[model samples]
Target: MALKPLGFYQRLQQLTLPAQQAFMAALCERQLPNYALYAQTTGCGDTHALKAVLDLVWEQLSVRGASIDFARQAEKLVECEPPADDDSFGARRALDVVVSLFSLLDTLRGEAPEAVLDVSRTSRAGVRAFIELTEGEEDAQRLALLIRDHPLTDDENGFQDAVLDAVSQPLNKALLKDVRRLGKNDGVSNLGLSLE
Candidate 1:
């Protein structure tokens, strides 16, 4: 069965705070290539800075009392945002990656109760945009069903399920490592974009 967005959000909410943070981080990790490709193609954003933020986020999740300057990190992320008027698919995907990381940071800061949900939505929206671009589907209703049933969408849901299952277990450095590997998906993004 296909996983609905609301159902996914509900499952995400059931995870503990650390688990939720890890989930968001894993999703962000999967999307990093989107920004990396955008930066490589257009030289518009800093891929290294975004990677640093995600690294710190993972450190906070895995290491106890790991003090992270999230406010400063958020400021750095703001600088990485793609121009709103770029209107390219690459820029849109890059923006989605940044937004997902920002939501993760907001969750870490206790500043947004729905930050996790926002990450979930943003990730799925990125996939949807990818489908729309490649498939050339113009009918709204048909595209909605097409997105719901797409193989990439299935991969996204399956990836999230795997991350949740790994995180729901006892939290530890090893588990976080495993989750990060899972998110890497052999360096492919949820939409199948890769740096290499």
Candidate 2:
């Protein structure tokens, strides 16, 4: 027999806390390295930069308990709902970061496979740092050595700009496209929150 449909809220409800936290953790893990690269290249070396998104997701999921559901919160985000209180600011930022990163990920997946490889390679040290932070791997010295050994020389600046520029517009366009798509699809999409 055909199954009945499930709305986004219903789907989220079906996810036990372990499953929800696991999904959130995986989402956080997926971006750790690339964001580490972005932070380092942009000269923001603080590891907290890497944790920002994860912290927000945790706040939404754990701190808020089951009340602040991901789909409901995401709906608020898609609808551009104003912050109901101080904490909502964190929620908004969390939504923006996830949506933006997810869009960039899509672009990297479909358009610039080479960039994805380059990111993986270039982010080696940062990834190690991330691992050390999250997993207690004790690789700080190695991460430092890796960074010091390969400073961005003058000759590489042009290549760096070329690589970065190629993805800039596409990233922005993807974010806009997703916002529009998610906004249009909210409450009506075939796959519910999974449509994101």
Candidate 3:
């Protein structure tokens, strides 16, 4: 069955805090390449800042009670956001990556229990946007169904499921490493963009 955002959010709320952090971190890792590619193309954003924030997220998960300054990481992420006026499709995707990282940081700081849901929704939205842009399907209802059936959407849901399963187990260094591997999805993003 396809994963629904609301259902996914409800499940996320049931997990332990560390588990949720791991889940969000995995998703952010998968999305990071989006920003990297955008930065490579436009020279408009910093992939390093985004990578630092994600690294901090994984660290927070691996070291229980790790004192990460989430606010400071967020400041760095804000600097990496694509400009509001850069209306290119790639720019919008880069912004989604930034926003997903921010949501992950917010979740870590305990400022937004719902932030994981935002990250999930944003990832799905990025898939939908990609489908719409590439396919040029203008009908809202048709586009919604198309997105639901798209291979990229299926891959996104499958990746999330794998991460959720991995994180549901007891936390450990091995588990964290495996979760990160799952997030990497063999260095390919949900949109099928390779890190290479």
Best by lDDT: 1
Query: Candidate 3 at residue 131, lDDT?
Result: 87
lDDT tens readout by residue for model 1, 1-196: 9966556568789888888889889999999998999999998999999999999998998888999999999999999999878999999999999989988998888867788788888988899889999998989999999999999999998998888889889889999999999887888998998989
Whose TM-score is greatest here?
1
Model 3: per-residue Cα lDDT over 1-196, one tens digit each? 9966556667778888778878888888888888889999899999987888888888887886889898888888889999889999899999988988887777777768787778888888888888898889888999889888999989888888788778879999999999998887787877889768
Task: Give the Å shift of residue 76 in candidate 1.
Answer: 0.8
In order, candidate lDDTs are: 0.90, 0.35, 0.85
Q: Model 3: how far is 54 from its true place, Å?
A: 0.9
lDDT of 3: 0.85
Write candidate 2's Cα lDDT for 51-143 as tens digits: 543444444433424333334333332333223352332233233334443333333224422323333233232333333443453467875
Instruction: Give candidate 3's error at residue 7 in angstroms.
Output: 4.2
